[model samples]
Every structure is written in C-alpha cells, then in structure tokens.
Target: MTIQSAFAGIMEAIRPLYDAREASNIAHLVMEHVTGLGKLDRIIHKDGDLPPAQEALYQQALQSLLELRPVQHITGKSWFYGMELTVSEQVLIPRPETEELVEWILLDHPTQPAWRLLDIGTGSGCIPIALKKQWPAADIWAMDVSTSALAVATRNAGIQHTPVRFVHQDVLSPDASKVLPSLNIIVSNPPYIRESERTGMQQQVQAFEPGIALFVPDNDPLLFYRRIAALAKEKLEPGGKLYFEINEALGQEVVALLVKEGFEDVRLKQDMFGKDRMVRCTKKEAAPADTTSPS
Candidate 1:
C-alpha cells in the first residue's frame, strides 16, 4: 500500500475508537515508527509505496490501535520534559501535567548546587530522572510499590544515564518512613483519581494502564497525599519544599491538608489547561523548646 493509503486506512479503521484528531495523530505515530520517516518526509513521500516489511508492521500497529491501545504503549516509549523514556503497562504513562510539576520545581530551585530530593510513586522515574538530568549535583531517590513498575523505571533511568536510587516500598506503609532520609525536596504525583471516576476515563487508560498507579479509594481519595505529606513532615529539612501533582478537583482540599499538616507557603498552581493540578509548600522550622524553668 502507498504511504498515503496506509495512513488513511489506519485513521479510518480507528475513527470509531478515537476522535478525528486523536485518530490522525495515532496513525501518524504508527506511520513514523514503522516507516522510519519524519512528518515532513512522510508528507513528501505521501504517495510512495510502503516496503513489504513496513506494510506488515503498519498493519499490526493499526490492529492494536483499533483495539484502543494507547499509542505510547504501541511505541513502547513516551516523551516527558523533552526526554523519551521507556514505558509499559507496568507503569503509568508520564503525562504533560506532571512535566509542569517538574518545571515548577526547576523554577523554584534553578541553580541549587546541591540538594537531596525524593519522588514518591515514581512511575517510569520520569520526575527524578528529568530533575537529575537538569541538576546533576542533586541526590535523587525514587520509590514505588510495584516491583514490575520499578523494573521499568530502572531501565528508563539507566537509558537516561541518570543515577537515581530506586527503592521498593509502599509510601502508605508505616515502615516506609524508616527507609527514607531527610531531604531538601520531596515530590509526588500520587494516586489522586477517585475510583468512582474510572467509568469516565478513556477506554485505553482504563483497560491498559496499571490501576495501582492511577487510582485511590473513593472514600479516601487523598490517601496517597495524606501519607506522603505526613512522611514529608517528618523527613523534610526545615524550610524544605514539598510538591505534588494533585487532582484538579481536590486542589483546595489538598492545600488545606498541607496547611493542617503545618506546611507553610502552600500554593496551588494550574497546568497549561488552567486546571489546578500542582501544589507546593515549605516545611516550617521547628520551634525551640521552652528553656526557662517554671517557678
């Protein structure tokens, strides 16, 4: 089949599964991956015939797309903060909003020579890896509860040549604090989506993504946030920063929780889409104990 025909066919086949724009985008990704052609080259060779091997690969990718598989899963990688990281069903696909959270951190500490940082629920190691790439002197650690997810994250961190310490522990566990160290910064994009919202998510996300990385109990939607904040309270250096990519709908709730936990300078920031998707705060220095004896 000609390049033009193949691309058009893939789009048409998946139109029912995705809208026009998304279908076209996925078709373009498949075409680029299979043909090893850039968008401009694809356009220039629109009518050129696909090689037999390319045709076979295109057909197989089209089938997966038709099944509502995420394009990144088919491509086996995703771009986050200008870095392409390997991804799998084992880890949640890094999202652009999370990149914004990283950007916020960079903006706040643009030129720190040395700092210790931790990322809780570090699926694919995107946040810590990206930060370490930017701040090489920073000591970075990432933890995840899922062993398979940690394996994927380890591979991505290796590919990026970012030396991030990976820990296998659930942040919700009481023992989790025992393994972590006091740090200058703590960040997390924890499970903030309520289980009740699952029905409204895309079929590809609901079906192919790891539920452990994406959801929280409906009755306790802030489960991860509460636990991670408490841990940060105990582990963050005085005046150290805490950051989170939160549920847009729960921005106020998360801000309140952080304040109640004694975090100061709490701020909720919006993503590109103007959704309240990120929050940052500072840990207050401890008060000196009463030195004067009572009469």
Candidate 2:
C-alpha cells in the first residue's frame, strides 16, 4: 500500500478514539517513526508507496493505538528536556508538566557553584537527568521503589549521559531513613492521583501505565506529599528548597502540610492550564542561640 493508504488506515482506526485533527497527527507521527521521514519529506512524498516492512510496522502501531496504548509506549521512548529517554509500562511516561518542575529548579539555582539534589519517586529519572544536564556541577540522586521502573530509568540516564545516583527504596516505608540523604534541594512528582479519579482518567493511562506510579488512596490524597515533606523536614538543609508537581485539587492542602512542617516561603503555582499543579517551599533557617545562655 502507498504511504497515504497506510496513513488512511491509521486515521480510520483511531477516528473513534481521537478527534479528526488529532487522529491525523498521531497517524503522521507513527508514519514518521516507521519510515524515518521528516515532516517535509512525508508531505512531499505522500503518494509514495511504503515498503512492506514499514507498512507492517505501521499496522502494528495502529493496532496498539486502537487499544488506547500511548504513542510513547508504542515507540518505547519519550522526549523530555530535549533528551530522548526510554520508557516502558513499568514507568509512567514523562509529562510536560514535570519539565516545568525541572525548569523551575534550574531557573532558581542557575548561579550556584554546586548543590545537592534529590528526586523522590523518580520514575524515569527524568527530573534528575534533566537537572544534571542543566546543573552539571551539582550532585544528583534519584529514588524509586519499582525495580522495573528503575531499570528503564537507569538506561535513560546512560542514554542522556547524565550521572545520577539511583536508589531503590520506598520513600514511604517506616524504615526508609537509611536510604535518605540530606540535600540542598528535594523535588518529587510522585503518585498523586486518587483511586477515585481513576474512572475519570483516559483508558490509555488507566490500563497501560503502572498504577503505583500514578495513584494514591482517595481518603489520603496527600500520602506521598506528607511523607516526602516530613522526610524533607529531616533531610533538607537549612534554606534548601522542596518542590512538588501536585494534583491541582490538593495544592492548598500540600502547601498547608509544608507550613505545618515548618517550611518557609511556601508558594503554590499553576501550570499552563492555570491549575494549581506545583508547590514549592524553603526550609526555615535555623534559629540562633541566645548569647546570654553562655555558661
């Protein structure tokens, strides 16, 4: 079949799930991946016949798309901060909002000669990998509980050529302190979606992505945030920063928890959609001892 015919098949297969324009876009991206063609080449050669192998690959991708699997998963890779990172069902696909979190950290500490950063529940290791790229001199560490997820993240770190210390430990466990380390900055984009919200999410996400990387109990939506914040209270250096990519609904609750933990300069910020998706705070400076107390 011609390239146009393959694209038509993709569009027809996806029409029920995606809008017309979006279906066309997905078809084009799949074609680009299969044929290794640039946008202009695809447009210019729309009438050209697709090789049998290329057509077969496109058909397989179309089937996966029809089942609501994410394109990133079908492609086995994703782009974050201009770096191509490998991904699997074991890891949550890196989202654009997380890029904003990385950018915020970089923007805030551009001139620091060096600093230490810890990324909790770092699924694909995107946060630390991206940060290491921006702050080459800084020490970076990432922790995640899923061994499968860490495997993908480790491969991505090598691919990006960014050295990040990847630790295997559950950040929520009662005995998790042994894996913890004090740092100048702590950032996390942990599982914040409530189980109640699962029904409302896209089937592509609900079915294909790792549940542990995406959800928390509705009754305790701040599960990860509270634990990470409490850990930060113990591990963050004085005047260090804590950042989170939060569920928009729990922005204020997260800020309140940080304040309760004695974080200073707490801020709740919105993403491009104006939803409160990010919260950041500074560790309060240590109080000085009174001179009169000297013996």
Candidate 3:
C-alpha cells in the first residue's frame, strides 16, 4: 500500500473511537513512527509505496488502534518535556500538563546551586528525568508502587541518561516517606481520578491504561495528594517546594488541603487549556530560636 493509502486506512479504522481531528492525529503519529516521515513529507510522498516491512508494521499498529489502544502504547513511546520515553500498559503515559509542571519547577529554581528532588509515584519517570536533564547538578529520585512501572521508568532513565534514583514503595504506606532524604522539592502526578470518573474517560484510557496508576477511591479523590503532602511535611527541607498535577475539578480542595497541611504560598495554576491542573506551594521555614539571654 502507498503511504497515503495506509494513512487513510488507519484513520478510517479508528474513526469510531476518535473524532476526525484526533483520528487524523493518531494516523499521523502511526505513519511517522512506521515510516519516519514528517507530516509535510508524508504529504509530499503520499503516493510512494510502503516497503513490505513498513507495511506489515503499519498493519499491526492499525489493528491496535482499532482495538482502542492509545497511539503512544502502539508506538511503545511518548514524548514529554521534549524527551521521548518508553511507555506501556504498566505505566500511565506522561501527559502534556505534567510537562508544564516540570517547566514551572525549572522556572522557579533556575539558579539553585543544587537541588535534592523527589517525584512521588513517578510512573514513566518523566518529571524527574526531565528535571535532571535540565538540572544536571540536581540530586533526583523517583518513587512508584509498581515494580513493572519502576522497570519501565528505569529503562527510560537509562535511555535518556538522566540518572534518576527509583524507589519501589507505595506512597500510601507509612514507610514510604522513611526511605527518602530531606528534599528541596517534591512533585507528583498521582492517581487522582475517582473510580466514578472511569466511565467518562475515553475507551483507550479506561481499557488499555493501568488502573493502579490512574484512579483514587471515589470517596477520597485526593488520596494521593493527602498522603504525598503528609510525606512532604516530613521529608522536605525548610522552604522546600511541593508540586502536583491535580484533577481540574478538585483544584480548590487540593489547595485547601495543602494550606491546612501548613504549606505556604500555595498557588493553583491552569494549563494551556485553562484547566486548573498544576499546583505549587512552599514548605514553611522553621521558626528561629530565641536569642535573648534574659526574658
């Protein structure tokens, strides 16, 4: 089949699962991955015949797409914060909002002489790895509950040469905070979606992505946030920062939780789409000791 034919075929097959623009985007992603052709190049070479091997790969990808698989899963990779990271059902595919969170961190600490950072529930290790790339001098660590997710994250760190420390520990467990050194920054894009929200999500996400990395109890949607914040209170250095990529609907609740937890300078920011998705707050500095000899 020609390039145009394969692209059109993939788009047609996935249209039932995605809208016109999204279908086209998925097709473009698959075509580029299989053929290594840019969109304009694909257009220019639309009639060019696909190599037999390329055609076979295209067929496999198209089948996966029709089965409601995410394109990143089909490609076994995702781009986040300008770096390509391996992804699978074992981990949540890193999202663009998380990249914005990373950018916010970078903007806030550009001149820090050293950073001791930890990313809780670091599924794909995207946040810590990207931060390490920019802050090579930083001491970076990542933690996740799943061994499989940690393995994927480890491989991405190796492939990207970011040198992130990965810990296998459940953030909910009391001991989760015990293994970490005092940190200058703590960040997480934890499982914030309530179980009830599952039905509202796209089929590819609900069907193919790992549930352990995407959900919290409906009664406790801020489960991860609360736990992570508690841990940060113990593990963060004085004046350290905590960041979260939050569920848009629970922005106010998260802010309130952080503030009540004694965090200061709490700020909830929207992503490019204007959803209240990212938050940052500073750990309160310790009060100074009294110096007067007589009171």
Record all residue pairs in model 3 with backbone atoms less than 3 Å apart, i.e. clashing.
none
Against the unseen true structure, what C-alpha lDDT does each candidate score?
A: 0.92, 0.89, 0.91
Best by the TM-score measure: 2
lDDT per residue for candidate 2 within 1-295, as digits (tens), equals 8777787888888898999998877887788888899779987898998888987888789889988999888888788999988989999999989988888887887785478889999898899999988888889999999999889889998988889999999999877657666789999999999999999999999999999999999899999998988888888999999999999989889999989988989999898888898999999989997779557
Clashes of each: 0, 0, 0
TM-score of each: 0.94, 0.95, 0.95
Task: Please report how far candidate 2 places residue 260 from its true position, in Å.
Answer: 1.1
- By TM-score, the candidates rank as 2, 3, 1
Residue 203: error of model 1 in Å?
A: 0.6
lDDT string, candidate 1, 2-87, tens digits: 99999889878888787799778888888888899989999999999998998888888988887888999988989999999999
Worst 10 residues of 2 by lDDT: 174-183
Model 3 misplaced stretches (Cα beyond 4 Å): 40-45
**Model 3 weakest lDDT span, ten residues long:** 106-115
Error of 1 at 271 (Å): 1.3
